[model samples]
Target: MTTPRKVTSLDVAKRAGVSRSAVSRVFTPGASVSDRTATKVREAANALGYRPNVLARAMLTGKSKIIGLVVAYLDNHFYPTVLELLSEALEREGYHVLVFMAAHTAHDIEDVVGQILDYQVDGLVLASVALSSDLANRCRASGVPVVLFNRKLEAEGELAVVSDNRSGGRMAADHLVSLGRTRIGHIAGWDGASTQRDREAGFVEGLHAAGLGMFAREVGDFRLPRAKAAARRMFDTSDRPDAVFVANDYMAFGVMDVLRAELGLRVPEDVAVVGFDDVPSAAWPAYDLTTIRQDAEAMVTITVSSLLAEIGGSNVTPPDPLPVRLVRRGTA
Candidate 1:
């Protein structure tokens, strides 16, 4: 039986009337190849079905060009928005994203990360995750560049692309104070996560700066029902706050639902409310939530670019605290 001939670089070089060395140099990056010869080699290679093995090329260059994208709690809109930007930005940089969803717990990542590391990813972007400092240290020690997105590392010298959480919290406080609302309370995110902790601290400091005392706060774990429970507690108590700032818009929406449906309270009039993240629903006519807007798209873009740069051998360090802004609406 006659078998089809296996195409090789020599065949391509012969067909293109160029030396095999020229064909090899044309495929290899930073290798000297004339423009006239490169065109001929590409055309010949295309006709001969001689596609280069990307894995082998990457191994030769000591770069995998695969990005590990770790997203915890994608149930929140913020993570999904960040993920969409990350996928697009990474793709544009000739890198593929190996996505992993960490179920809402630091413990869950222990098992999931094994797979991400197995993919031989060039770099990693942790999307609002609360990785333990020890695990993060191990990741760094293993020679993978890790960049945190929308979250900060507790330890020093760790790379991160994080929003100005303290500033965002202060912004929320300033807006509430401007409305002449006192007795401000906070509905915070997960207690262990850096974003939640920093936002809570910033809000507290901001209220202090405005000459107001923080009445009380409850942890929502960045969830709806938990936020509702916290808000319900505030409503049920005899001594309750007049206005509240809930960290993240999803929780804020939950707080609003409780205020309107369960407690029958009017927003801004009865209990002025604010939230963080400023998710798409924040600007909707129904919610119209006055919240701190963390530019999810921009954050994702910068993080992806930084990670790709590191993967491609660029010695780039991401900004310590990424920028966040205020998106004022009607809740407060």
Candidate 2:
């Protein structure tokens, strides 16, 4: 059996008795074409079973209408929600997303970004991933717009959209202090992340303002198993903390589980727990974890708008970090 020849736009144009350019304009989004020409092109395309080749048009227009998304990991519920929102927003804008997985390290991200750039993506969004200065320069030279979501770079003028993590941390600390919990402890996330750094800094500043120091501290590295182990170590002692601030909701769930299950500690009575990122699970009755809300929808909106603006030849400034508010629940 022989393979059939693929129908091209020329075939449709010949059948419609219209210029090839008219058929192209009809398929091109936002392109102006007369109603009569469009009707003829549609009828001919249906008869010939000819579909406009997006990649072929991209070669002519120099716009792939594709956005490359690089993510470190999606173990945290917050990231998955953001990913879904970003995908939806881009789809509505007539763009497609090409997702790439990479480790959080600079080297790994650099390698992954190199691969993404090769696809001629119109823009790049780094979610929970950082881009190095060298890689940033290369992307700039290539004229590809880059946006950091839930992440940031030390370099100036990089576009990023994220929740106000520092303020959220301070709010958590204030809430715990107002409850008259003096022996406040903290479960830290990965030391390398900007979110972890800013959140911890604000929490420490709040503690200092109250004339208190951390009763105990342990590094969870943003993993559930590590958080559980850290909880065990923090609570096993007779001189345990009366309250704890967990870095993120994902780790908080583990800390809460270990507190109630392994250590048999009563929450908010024996020890108050506060967490960041009010993920859906945090509101569940089982945990009812009081946390800092990140406003994922707001962040997604800003990220998508900023990225598209940059892609449209607009010089975009990084927007102010989205505001976060304290969510009260049974945990705290």
Candidate 3:
């Protein structure tokens, strides 16, 4: 069968007994058109099954109504939730999300971002990835609004939305210490992530304030296998910690699994555990992990609002970091 002919605005205008310009105005957002005329145009377009060409319209209006989202990985439970929230928020604002998964390397990010730019997205949100200085400068020069979500760049003049990781770290340390856990250890996330650095610093500071020090530390690189290996090394030692804090829930789950299944240790009894990013799994019957909540709702709301403002030329300065809270549960 042959494809049906495409319907055009002129056909709708003719059928609605109005000028083509009137139909164009009716289809364009924020364009001046009377309610009666818009209704007529809509009825005519429906009858003819005429859909406006979005690309052509974007060319005319100089706005794609598209937001590019760059994420390195979605395996982490926290990031998938954040991505869903961002998509919902952007949709509510009449924008579409174009997601790009970049590789771990800086060059990969730069290439992917360059491809995103080719689509002329209205704005960009970088999640859990940092852009190179050259790419950042290119984005700035292009005048496209760029916002970092759950990540921060050392370069000045870039917008970011993140949880107060330092405070969360301190809160975790304080809770473990309050339980009289003198030999407290830490399982850190990826070394290069800003979240990892801040959390570690705050935990160290909290331990010092309590007149104690870290009994042991290991890098998990935000992976489950590495975290399990770290747990094994820590627990197999003669000076095994009485308590431990894992940087995020993903790694926390691994540490907990090893403690219970492999090491035959009970949580909060043999080894009290605290984690970050109070992900949904943390509250499961299996883990029930006490953790620092990153306020996903608040983080997503601020990120969308900030990115929209930058896109609309209303705000340029980045907002302050949002606060985190300790969520009490069975663990620790």
Candidate 4:
């Protein structure tokens, strides 16, 4: 038996009694086509069961209409929301998202990014994952535009969109101080992450501005288990913190669980708690966590617009940091 030949646009144009360019315009987004001509093209396409070859179209136009997204981890509640917003925003622009998960090791990141490049994506978005300078240089040399979402790389010529985490940290500190927390401590996230450093710095600045200093500090590494362990050490000490500001809501949940379930400490009574990233779980009755809201929708919108601007041959300046707000709740 012989395989069937694929349907072509020319065949549809002949069947519809229209020019081949009319059929092309009907399938091409943003291309001009009359309503009657589009209707006739669609009917002919449906009757002939014809579909445009996207790969061939991409080869001809030098555009894949695909954006590559690299993410380090999705366990955090924040990133899942970011992914959803990105997908929706890109779809509206007639683009699709291709996700790539980079491992912890540099070698793994290089390898995975190389595979993404193989797909010839029109642009790339890195979410909380930094590419090595060498890999970044390679991407630049290849002429593919990249935008960093919720993180920043130290390399030049890279665009980033992030919340004003420093201000959020200051807000958290001021809120705790207003609550009359004398002995305040903090559970920091990963040491190397830029977000962690900025938040910690702002927290310290806010504390000093209020004539107070951090009582104790622990590294959570943005992991629940590590946060729990850090909470144990802090609470077990004789001078436990009267208030604790966790780096992110995921770690905050672990810290709260350790304080309430494991140590039988009453939240906001024994120790007030605050967190960053007003994740959905933060609003639950059990947690009701006071947190800094990082507007995911705004971040996603800016990121997509910046990326598309670059892809459209426009030089994009780094966007100003998005604002964050403190969402007051029962915890603090």
Q: Please give each candidate's TM-score.
A: 0.82, 0.93, 0.92, 0.89
Off by over 4 Å in 2: 1-5, 47-49
Q: Count the backbone clashes (under 3 Å) in each candidate.
A: 1, 0, 0, 0
> Candidate 4 local accuracy as lDDT?
0.90
User: Which candidate model has the greater lDDT, 2 or 3?
Assistant: 2
Top candidate on TM-score is 2
Relative to the unseen true structure, what is the C-alpha lDDT of residue 73 in candidate 4, on a scale of 0 to 100?
Answer: 84
Top of the candidates by lDDT:
2
Which RMSD values do the candidates have, in order?
3.9, 1.9, 2.0, 2.7
lDDT for 41 in candidate 3 is 96
Cα lDDT tens digits for candidate 1, 105-158: 667776777678877778888777777778887887778888887777667766
Error of 3 at 297 (Å): 1.5
Please identify which of the two predictions, 2 or 3, would achieve the higher TM-score against the true structure. Answer: 2
The CA root-mean-square deviation of candidate 4, after full C-alpha superposition on the true structure, stands at 2.7
Worst-scoring 10-residue span by lDDT in model 4:
102-111
Candidate numbers sorted by lDDT from highest down: 2, 4, 3, 1
* lDDT (tens digit, per residue) of candidate 4 on 1-332: 99898899999999999999888889887789999999999999999999987767777677889999998889889889989999999999999999999854557778988999888889999887756778877887887888878777766777889999999999999999999897999999987777898899999999999999999999998888999999999997667999999999999999999999988999989999999999998999999999999999999999999999999999999888899999999999
Q: What is the C-alpha lDDT of each candidate?
A: 0.82, 0.92, 0.90, 0.90
Predicted structure 3: lDDT:
0.90
